[model samples]
Target chain A: MPITTCVFDAYGTLFDVNAAAAQAADDPDFPRLADLWPAVARDWRRKQLEYTWLRAVADRHCDFWQVTQDGLDWALAAQGLDDPALRARLLALYRQLPTYAEVPAMLAALKARGLTTAILSNGSPDMLNAAVASAGIAPQLDAILSVETVGVFKPHARVYDLVGAQFGCAKDEVLFVSSNGWDAAGAAGYGFRTIWVNRAGDPPDRLYADPHHTLGNLVSIPDLL
Target chain B: MPITTCVFDAYGTLFDVNAAAAQAADDPDFPRLADLWPAVARDWRRKQLEYTWLRAVADRHCDFWQVTQDGLDWALAAQGLDDPALRARLLALYRQLPTYAEVPAMLAALKARGLTTAILSNGSPDMLNAAVASAGIAPQLDAILSVETVGVFKPHARVYDLVGAQFGCAKDEVLFVSSNGWDAAGAAGYGFRTIWVNRAGDPPDRLYADPHHTLGNLVSIPDLL
Candidate 1:
């Protein structure tokens, strides 16, 4: 089936998770702490995903901001780096993350092609909005939906339902793009047409849900659509 | 609040994931595909976790054996390694994984101390039984339970509930131990006295359900109990 609306996952898809960490690593002001930033970033991402899965199974809901902070705290302690100010700055950077180089141009292309572009993220509404606003790409979106409204994270069918409900389309009509393999598989399992943005060259998850398309980056998405 | 029972997570906690892959890597007989083994193992582990989470949320049930095979198949394709005999042999090795050096002695210590020891794992019943039997550790366990009966994976309260149900004790009387930080947090959150086996020095999850104790390895679990 032909795809109509295109929904993108926010983190690691549209935004670069390592950019802030890489920048921090290169900063002369914090030489000793520089070595720990990448590990910290990786742990933070791991914790975020772990929290989302745990909360979903526990039937608990918290805003992504809270989870992000919780993950950051764990990472900080794990890395044995306990500077509160540095921790605060790293988190602040997350809230105001820059979009991937291809995001704005790709969104523009999708819009020009008369396709609706939206963000279906695990991010909280405020987090997603602030990120889009800071990146100056809020105007490019037809809608910004978050798992917070549904009280569950992505890969949960109800979270995906929010998109179909809002757009008045079947799941298959939506082309969902995600840099996270599990998220792509989840959306595919939920019956959405899926594209996996293999940004890091990570292997595809070995589950039943296979992506309908795969690309190295979002830059190729517009052409595929 | 003393722990009267010590429950162990089966995979990775007692069994090494990399051992089989390492063996495969060193096989002169299969030199052409040996290097791909680690990636295959990593992807297989990743997919196994993904399937468990997805199936739990979907209210679906499949034995861990089924999920393990599915994961292995996906890993093979993702790595472009498609030897059926090699895949079968690797998986067969998984069924008879060697327990970590500390596992038997630690269980013996717990047994000598008159504390109950059990296998509370995400493995299917048959898989868990076969592994215990093959590892020659069956005599050490008071009971072996799997999430297969509950139709959900660990981090789900129902899976943890099996412990209390089987022992006729409150959750707090049992101390659940896992190398997986997320499982430790889940068991802690479900009200078990928890001990995290931090074999890899990974940080605690920001699960809000912190383990009561953390040890470098299972070598000290009996002392804690």
Candidate 2:
């Protein structure tokens, strides 16, 4: 099926998830993060994703913003950096994360080609709005779907259902892109033509389905279409 | 309600999850693991639980044994340990992992008090049977429940349902214990009195529910009753 809609996972895919910590580390005020930011970033992202999956399975639905804060708390504590000020700064930065260098143009090219584009994320609606507005890419997106509407997180069939519900596209007529191997695999299993943007060169997850294509970045996303 | 049944998570609770890697590291043949065993064990356990949660949310059910091996593969690759022999040896060690020093005594004490004792775990039946038998604690456990019977992994309500289904007890009548804070929290959400065996001194998970009690080890479990 020719792709009619392109759905992207927001956090790690369109927005650089590590940018908040990386940005905070650059600030002279947070001297502690200069060497510790990478670990904090890695653990924060890992715990955030883990919390979503746990909540999804446990039937404990919460907003991704709350989960993001919970994750940052765990990550900060894990690294023994217990400063509440640093925590607040990191979260503020997370709300307006910098998009990947190619996101705006690549998304624009897809729009120019008359293909529908949307973000299907575990993020809350407000968080997604802040991110889209901050990145100035709202015009490029036809819709921004969050898991909050369904009261569940990603990899759940319910979350994926929002895609076809919004676009009126068949499962096969969507190209789902994500930076997470598990999310891409989950989308693949849900029958979307999936692309795993493997930014970190990680190994493939041994999941139920394999992504149709893997790319190093989104610069080549327009080419794939 | 008084606790009539005592249910414990198998891996990392009754059984020492790190023992296999720690044992393998002591072997002269695997010189590489002497210093790296802790990282391998930590990553392996984290990925194992993460895969379970992912598969659970995605509705892609697989046996815990498969998830275990998949997790091991990810951990090994992360540590740059690519030896197939080492991989095989690790899997062999995992099948009969050592029980925590206090597990046998702890379970026996609960059984002596006329409380129904069992293990509720994501481990496949065969794997759970092997571990239980290997630990020589099979006599103390009235039932060994595995997620394979329900075709789902834990923190899912269905997996927890196995506990009451097997013993014909009310959710409140059961005392659920898990080494994982999220698991304990999940059981709490499921309406069972929960205890989080915080072996690692880790921070509390900011999940929907908190474990009713926290203990350093299973040794103090019987006293709680």
Q: Please tell me which predicted candidate would have the highest TM-score against the true structure.
A: 2
Q: Check candidate 2 and list the clashing pairs.
A: none
lDDT computed for candidate 1:
0.83
- Show where candidate 1 strays beyond 4 Å: A33-36, B1-3, B32-47, B58-61, B70-85
Error of 2 at B70 (Å): 1.6
- Tens-digit lDDT string for candidate 1 (B1-225): 667888889998988876776676676766755778778888788778777877776555588898888888878788777788778777888888888998888898899998888988889988888889988988889999888788888788899999888888878788888888888888888888888888878766787678888888889877665
Give the runs in model 2 whose Cα sits over 4 Å from its true position: none
TM-score, model 1 to reference: 0.91
How well does each candidate superpose onto the true structure, as a TM-score?
0.91, 0.96
> What are the candidates' interface root-mean-square deviations?
2.5, 1.1
Model 1: lDDT of residue A162: 90
lDDT of 1 by residue, A1-225 (tens): 678899999999999977766766676766756788888889788778878877888776788888999988888888788877777778878988888898899999999999988999989989998999999998789999999888987678899899888999878789999999888888888889999999777667756578888899988788887
